[model samples]
Target chain A: MTVQISDTARPAAAGTSSGRSLRNLTYRPEAGALIGTLGVFVFFAIFGGTHFLASAGTAAWLNVAAELGIIALPVGLLMIAGELDLSVGSVLAASSMTMAIVSGYWGAPMILGIVLALGVGVTAGALNGLIVTRTNVPSFVVTLATLFGMAGLTLGLSRVITGTTSVALNPDPGSKAVFGTLIAGQFEVAILWWIVVALGVGWMLQMTKYGNWILAVGGDKESARAAGIPTNRLKIALYTGSGFGAALVGVIQTILYNGAQVANGQSFVFNSIIAVVVGGVLLTGGYGSVVGIVFGTLTFAIVNQGIYYTGWNSDWASFILGVLILAAVLMNNTFRRLALSHAPRSGKKA
Target chain B: MTQPLLRLTDVGKSFVGTNALEDISLEVHAGQVLCLLGDNGAGKSTLIKILSGFHAPTSGTIEVDGQPVVFKSPRDVSAYGIATVHQFGGTFQLMSVGRSFFVGVEPTKGWGPFKRFDKGLAGEIAVREMQSLGITRVTDGKRLVGSLSGGERQALAIARAVYFGANILILDEPTAALGVKEATHVLRIIMQARAKGVAVIFVTHNVLHAMMVGDHFAVLIHGRKADDFHKGERTREQITDLMAGGEAMADLEAELAALEASAGSTGRS
Candidate 1:
């Protein structure tokens, strides 16, 4: 029996000889997204000229990318774990409205307004988590319900309390400096917050045990449970974290623009997902990276903002965005297939 | 005699007015492989689930080392050194071998907020443990589980169970999906695990494979133990006949003969 086992093991050892060859760099998961990003950047650089590359011109999209990236990070993690958060758009609008109503309309302290705004997001997020877990509904459907539900509530409340659908805020210098100000008069302070969020979430997903739990839960929840991982709690935590991301962006928007609107923030619902997918995060979950998502966000931002700098018809932005996303995803699929097919070097044995 | 590592007496399980398993009794001693053989719907799955703590037996008691123990959950059973490796090896395909090996109980380094999964330690241990199990190709701990062949996945799962201190290992059809060579690899791993004093309950329908490594055998038919014997007490043919439920095979043969006779008469007409 021992000799037979050794003989059977020999084929595997022979196969391993070629398995040691370094996988082609382009076959990495993020390779497609990286190439797509560069392709778009170079295209725009030539067309948009130095103005597009200049600091102020760069911030045009950087500011947009910052807010979207912040939301996308958590959304990307949720996607990687095999869930969705469509309510982020509503959460963004609702939180923004909450801050405006409390500080601008009700004359509350700016700090209180900020707290209330973020609190609303956390509460909504927790509720979303609870309903999905308890009722066993697809998160896409549950969050969709909350998206409209929160949007309606925000509009109704804003009208009832402030007598309008929009409200303005005048934040104190301290609150504005931290959450609302643009660093160096060009970059939005939200960029700093985006970096902070990326680092924190990136570390959590890559370096910690919790990260593995998320991957396991997303990969196969039954298997994860069988392995003794707390699949449900991990999912709920992801939802809550997503909510926090959306809400933080809400607070930033409210403070940066000094106003809020009930109709605003709807675009973020799909945009963040687009950025995450373009970044190489699988929509089905269980595979992705923070760095991939970051690049995806930048790629998305560049395309969305670069069109304006290119002197093209602004109406074609949506069309162009659609094409870019499909191309990026196709490129990603090709690279993944290449990576999975890469064989071993076949001479070495353990 | 030494106490068996695990013993189930008159174990029965039912769900929603259906008895999935009934009056099953078995015992597995340390360093022994008890091959549980059955056909489809013969309650092999139910019996394994009850043993692994995924389901509670509606009747009978489970004893661990001579003490009656009730398992409320898989976690509870795992705490008592019981582990179950399902048919597909229960591995996360997209994860690295090291990450999959140390998934639920990962080792951490650094202080309070700085703590993180110790990848180096996990990789080193995963490769070492797998090599010890005779899987020489899985030297790179970073290889994705999906990239592994079916046999290698089974070896990794079994190695993981033994390394994590599983005294009673329940493998549910670990060799069912593999080709002949891969099945041999899995059988070898089971033998290695048994030599290390782990009690193994190997569930399969393959009489030949079961006869290869099983020291004690139990044939379950319609949720009941139809036969129980030690090595040398039963021949491979008898075990296969038993798994086919002796009299039922005759009934099946009769039904098939009847159908053939009817077809022949019609064709003649």
Candidate 2:
């Protein structure tokens, strides 16, 4: 509910830098993300030459981007709900283990493995949510605690039971075609999953009752509580969604490589957050979109792998990513101010 | 068909170390607006919260339509036709006007996880509710509430309350921070709500607005009632005085007595 109230109609329309108040131009978050996207593409296309546009190269970068983007979608939704899930990595590991132990180890049916994996993810998410909702601690601290606890459990249980940090799986032929196969040689079916999820999440964020409540909780918890939104329940769902996101990623990776690793998905913790924010989500809560997150993830992937295609040092990838995130965020804030300058100005008695 | 919509008998509330309300009693009959006025730090908020079932008073009981009830949450209050519209309007601004209007109890279709909000039904209801409140200008249910004025948000809050079958409403400072125009708009909606036979307990410091809309006025000073009056017994000046602390009146009495003694001494000289 932090609406900027400024009437931009009365401003002097002079085109001078000093005369043109930043308020006159309505810079939307979508606009900023779009512009950043174009900027990154032009920069890479000029420097990286044919490889940046090569279908094989595009697919390779998109493969990584698809994985990151899938998780980012839910993470963005969670951020908008004013909550976080530090335990996503553990959730991913646990989900993969469920699939590995159930199908590969126990020789169970593929459907059972899929169901067990999803169930494990949902349960872990619910537990995190229940603990956070019922407790008075900040979600940052609470989720962080769950993150460490689940990681320990994932590792201990893996070593004691699976007896190794990783598990190799060869899916049944039926399962491979249905859930694991690559489509069109280049695009992983996971990309389609990512795309469908993005569309669905985006629509939900914009159109649904739950979507509105998510923004409300993120914008102000107390106000959402007063509105009788069942903010606690909504937050728990958000956590559960985050867990579900991680689990999906785990399933995709397990299918892609036909294996499960306890150490996988650690990088997602920060990468997903950056993708969400770069896409225009406010860390403070209640702003941004699914499309923006998708663009942000693509931009990151392009920068990460694109650096190598340009024959530059791969180490420069991290540095470039840091810059891109910072720059996109700065522009996003600027756009927010611009978009808001036209609103009805407050503090005026008249 | 009509028993008193809501009743509070010997309702008392205690905080960690202090009694905010002690043996306080009030009744909200249908179609009546009761304004609860108080200075800062008064127990108006506490009283509102209790009526909304946020905090069960340490001692005392409450009744709705002559039926004694114990409420564990605000949802329980809703079952009894009581809803609270706090100062913030308690809405999601990024959400569409329609969605914010029908949160929690949204009309859903399909089955299980695939269930989606019935947008057409929601929009129709939102439009009708808002129109009933005479907010006819807002036609686009898809518009985000962040675009609405402060008064519009308040009216929407009230409309949402009535739409949800709340017969008794507890509004917390509906116009405390609004401008003249927005506040006037809210007053208009309050009048419409009154016409609908809803019992409203309005909590505010604006005696003028209270006099305009409220059928009864109760003033709380330092967690206690300084005075209670109907439209005839209270004035703008009287309510303002009680709100400034009872010490102001005592100081005025002492000054008047000292002046009388000086006048007498001068007459003798």
Candidate 3:
């Protein structure tokens, strides 16, 4: 064994140490997302001028980012685990309505409304997990079913209970301070929540056994099961996490806007996915980083909000976004290829 | 002679009405290589699944070290120290070597919420283990599993199983997809594991490869054990013929000869 090591491993180690470090940075999973984020930020900073670069302008995009980031982080985890939760949009709407109707329409304690709202999200996620695991159906189809079904359920329930499609909420002081308040008269309190979520998730994915299981499950479910990972349980937990994230976002929206709308969260479904994909997470699963998702969210928000600051037509924002997504994906694919093709040269020399 | 490390008695598995496996018994001893040889649809996968606890036996009992145990899931089988390395090494392609090496059981440092996967320790141990198995090219455990060659990936899987203290290692078609040199490397690794007293169940249809490392051999034909013997008891021809379901190979030769003879006669006429 010692002979083999000296013969095969030494040359490769010696050859690559000098230049590989720089190349390694480019090959990292988050490299594309980081570059994309910076590219978009610069683009907006140029066109939107001093206003886009200033404090209030930063707050505008930061607020949008914080809300989308919270949802995108868990959604990113689900994608890494090789599943999709399309119903996050509906879960957000449902939870927002649940909290609004309970606290606003029924005049119940704020705490109860908050609990029930989050509960609705967790339950919906668990249900998605159960249906996917128990049946051989793909999670895409299962979650898609929940997306429409939950939307109808939330809309129907809201109309029945409040007798209106929209309901108003006047949050209690404590809840307002925690969930709804704007910091410095500009930045949304949700930004703090986004930071906490990012740190927690980044640690879990990079440091925990659960993170390893999620990657394994995403890479190959059958192989993961053979390795003794509880694939079903892990997947269910991921779905649940995404549900909770959406619900939290819903509650935040309800508190911030002082009202709930059945149609409020539909944009989040694709938007969160867009952020995650732009962040360099593989849409097919089994590969991504939390850092990438964060960068992706920031990039998306900058482009989304920065367009309004520019004198150009707002309609072209989506066209720019469409191009950016393609470019980021192409860049990610190239890095992925580089990563896969990496091999120690000693084997070839031998 | 002594108690087999693992023993199966009258194990049978049926899906609906069709029996994928029948009442077949087998024993595997520590420090020995048991080669399960079969052709397509010969119930090799079914038996492997049953042993790995992916499926429960419809009938029969399994004994590990002379004690009866029921395997309801892969986790249960693993608790008995049986590690299965599926074809393609079963390593997550997108994960780093150290991470994939410790999947489902990461080594942690610190305590409680502050505790985290010990990346440095994990990488060191993974590289050390793979090198010990003669996979010297994998000096850096931070490399992606997808980047490794087929043989190196197999080494990684075997190294992981060994590092985790698995007493019985089941390799499902480990060499089927490998080149000649890579297959030799895997066969050598199998011997090294056996030298460490790990019982190995090497499953494959390649008679030559099986004959290289197998101490004990079992040929399965249509869900039944056609023959079971120690090495040298049967030649390559006999093993090959048996794997083809006893008379199938012989019948094929006869049919080919008759067809040639008839063609000659018709041309003359």
Best by lDDT: 3
lDDT of 1 by residue, A1-350 (tens): 33532332221122111343345455455677768777887898889887777766677877888899899999998898899999999999999999999999988999999999999988988898888889999999999999999999999989998899999999888988999998878778998888788888888888899988888888888878878888777878888888899899999989989989998789999999999999888788887778778878888888999888888888988898999999989988787666555444343644
Give the candidate order by descending TM-score: 1, 3, 2
> What is candidate 2's CA lDDT for residue A307?
89
What TM-score would each prediction reach against the true structure?
A: 0.92, 0.83, 0.90
Pairs that collide, model 1 = A16-A346, A17-A345, A17-A346, A17-A347, A18-A344, A18-A345, A18-A346, A19-A344, A19-A345, A20-A345
- Runs of candidate 1 with Cα error greater than 4 angstroms are A1-27, A341-350, B251-269
Q: List residue ranges in candidate 3 displaced over 4 A.
A: A1-22, A344-350, B254-269
Indicate the worst ten consecutive residues by lDDT in candidate 1 chain B.
B138-147
Evaluate model 2: give its lDDT.
0.77
User: How does chain A of candidate 3 score by TM-score against the true chain A?
Assistant: 0.92
Per-residue lDDT of candidate 2, residues B235-261 (tens digit)? 788788888776778898899898898
Give the per-residue lDDT digits (tens) of candidate 1, residues B128-170.
Answer: 9998988988777776788788888998899899999999999
Better of 1 and 3 by TM-score: 1
RMSD of each: 8.5, 8.6, 7.6
Pick out the ten consecutive residues of candidate 2 chain B with the lowest summed lDDT: B136-145
Top candidate when judged by TM-score against the true structure: 1
Candidate 3 per-residue lDDT, tens place, B133-208, comes to 9888887778899998899899999999989989999999999999999899999999989999999999999999
